[model samples]
Target: MAVEAPFWFTSLAGLGAVYLSVVFLRLLPYLVLYLRQPKDLRRCYGSWAVITGPTTGLGRSMAMELARLGFNLVLLDLHPDNLREVSDTIREAHSVQTKTVVFDLSLVGTEKGDEAMRRLREAVEGVDVGMLVNNAAVAKPGALYFHEADVERLVTMIRVNAMALTEVTAAVLPGMVKRGRGAIVNVGSGSTVAVPSFPLYTVYSSSKRYVEQLSSSLYVEYKSKGIDVQLQVPFYVHTNMLSSAVKERMLLPAFVATADDYTRAAVRWIGHGPIAVPVAGQQLQWFLAAVVPEFAHNWYRLRKHLQHRAILWNLN
Candidate 1:
């Protein structure tokens, strides 16, 4: 015969089981989504997709992927030469048509910016813009205290990362609403969603927090209207955006993904949810990071940023 556990021990065991059940239930849907085949994006959304900052990194990769899948593209970036290069490359490789728009996102609220916005509005006027990838962003070159940071650069980061994303979304959402369907994929940082405090990278993470809240709200508001607003949060992508030293340190395949690899996963999750951690490994990393206490997350991030600073400045 087996001995029965004490009353407190039995109660504790029951609670632990209940907690685990809740977590499993929460994660079940995302697991299903990750395993499922991708939606026919052209059928579900529209024919043409607009990608901002489409000249480099994930934005460029996303543009190419969509074009490969037979979606016409409207590419927007600050440089005409780079835009022309990408447009030519896509035209040469894919049968899809391309439109290049040179718009400076940092000039979102200025006089020249007003004219540029008007032009951008005109550029997409007749196109069935089924998707908008708000992929442009800026971050500090190094980890530094808020007060120690360059004020001008921080302001530009806010303008490009947050303000411009908002403006571009505003520009594209109306058409989607009128057409009765569309998708907006806002590139977001895991720093905002995966941790309690980002410490030295405060501004970038905070701006992404805004993107997170906005995307979730839009998803709720537009789901019935046939619009899917998704925030794709990535942990660490091996892109030019990251320093060579940091990339070297993050050489683990599971921890850091290439831009193309991450974008391919990102495309699979569109229209399925308001938020997605596309890379399966990053999903697990996010879960473990979230399980840690807030104090520990904050302390660890601060220490890591400090070490990064030491490496960059040769202080070590």
Candidate 2:
């Protein structure tokens, strides 16, 4: 005997097929990209990469990584001695060219900022800059509410975190567009996503959201022009930049990573854009955030912050 399925049952089966198809279609390319090794991004973008804030932490690490990738560097930072050291190290290790530009990003929009930019342009003039890592940013002293933060501190954070990124991108992107090749890796915060509320880092959180937005929109605008723009949302690295909470949890795999380890993973994923967390632990944290309830995540984050505050500053 032949049996016929009900109309609703057939419809449900069709819908299920469509859903699976959509999911597979959306995920396949990213999976393929992830599985395959990326092309030499430095060769594709240009021969030189200008890294801001390369004196220490993420900046220094990325600069070193790029040097290994055979790209000459124009390293910008506030410290002259560190800049010279990084340059010497890169040259000694890789035989690639290096230029050090001691510039203060916070001084943007002033006479000093203009002078700095002029010097920066001169430093990069003869080189073909291929990659731009906007990794330099200023974090608040510790967890503090908006009202509790000093106005100058808040303003400096905005200048370094937001304004500097915009200005630096503008400085280099035009050449990339004209040359028909380039890649930008703007380091972003997981605070805006993994811990969205981020109770005490109000301004810093907002500034990171701005970076995410800027990277995302610009990616859309320039992807057709052979430019790769990506925002990397890394959770934590055991650098001098770590806040008290992360510093306390430095031994935990999920909480902190050394700059060298983090940078190696991050540099490999450079063109894997528009966002990625190369550290497996941080990547897992991102996954859990997606499936977890908002209120629950908020409570968990708040608890960690409050506990760290008590330990570090004796705040209740």
Candidate 3:
């Protein structure tokens, strides 16, 4: 005769079984999705790429990598110094033709911003831009609550992250459509998926969410037209965008992909098709966030908030 287990032990064992079953059930769809790599992104060498926020982080790294891959570059940024450095580096290192446009994308529609884009358009008027990277972004820290947040900054964030990307896409799209080929790579954040409780970056994340959604809708609209619009979702990267304290806390155990890593993966996959998640592990995280139960997802978000706080405190 078999010995009967204690009630508490039996209950714990049953709970563990249920948890494991839920995890496996959630993972099955991702496993299938991950195994099937889309075929269109394999050949992207020699394409012309226009990269916004091209002076630092993922944007800068992408400009360099694309140049190395034999693509001509149109680099846009607010800082002329950094833009010059990046252009010179790419020109010397890869011998690829490079153009630098210095303009505050957040200020678009203003006399200065409009002039900048107009000048950029004139500079590259006839040149075919095979890819447009909408990667520039900004955030104001410490104001975690809505009431405390800077309205001006929020407006600026929307202008740059949402409006500018839209305008730049519009500026380049007619030519791309007329030519019947091109790609638009919009850089989005994982925060949009996790929906961080940090109110300071609320506007920033919201804008990114808009980009991701718009990119997807545009992809569907233009698929038959031969224009691939890709949404590149990335998690926390070691960039100037985050505070030092936040960076220390947000850095994951998994490879904190450098801008170069992101750029390479992004450019390669952009050619494959629309909607590429550059980081592998984080892609799973995104998938789970998308399909998971709302309550469960909110619980996970709460845990993330706590984790972010803990990381910030530890840094201090």
- What local lDDT does model 2 show for residue 161? 95
Kindly list the per-residue Cα lDDT of model 1 for residues 161-263, writing each as its tens digit. 8899998889889999999999999999999989988887888888889999999999999999999999999889977766788667634656888889999
Query: What local lDDT score does residue 112 receive in model 2, on the 0 to 100 scale?
Result: 96
- For the record, the alpha-carbon RMSD of candidate 2 to the native fold, in angstroms, is 4.4
TM-score per candidate, in order? 0.92, 0.86, 0.80
lDDT by candidate, in order shown: 0.87, 0.82, 0.75
What is the TM-score of candidate 3?
0.80
Which pairs of residues collide in candidate 3?
40-272, 41-271, 41-272, 144-199, 144-200
The list of candidate 2 runs beyond 4 A from truth reads 1-35, 243-246, 249-251, 314-316
Checking candidate 1 for backbone clashes, the offending pairs are: none
Which of 2 and 3 is ahead in lDDT?
2
TM-score (C-alpha, index-matched) for candidate 1: 0.92
Cα RMSD of all models vs. native, in order, equals 2.3, 4.4, 4.8
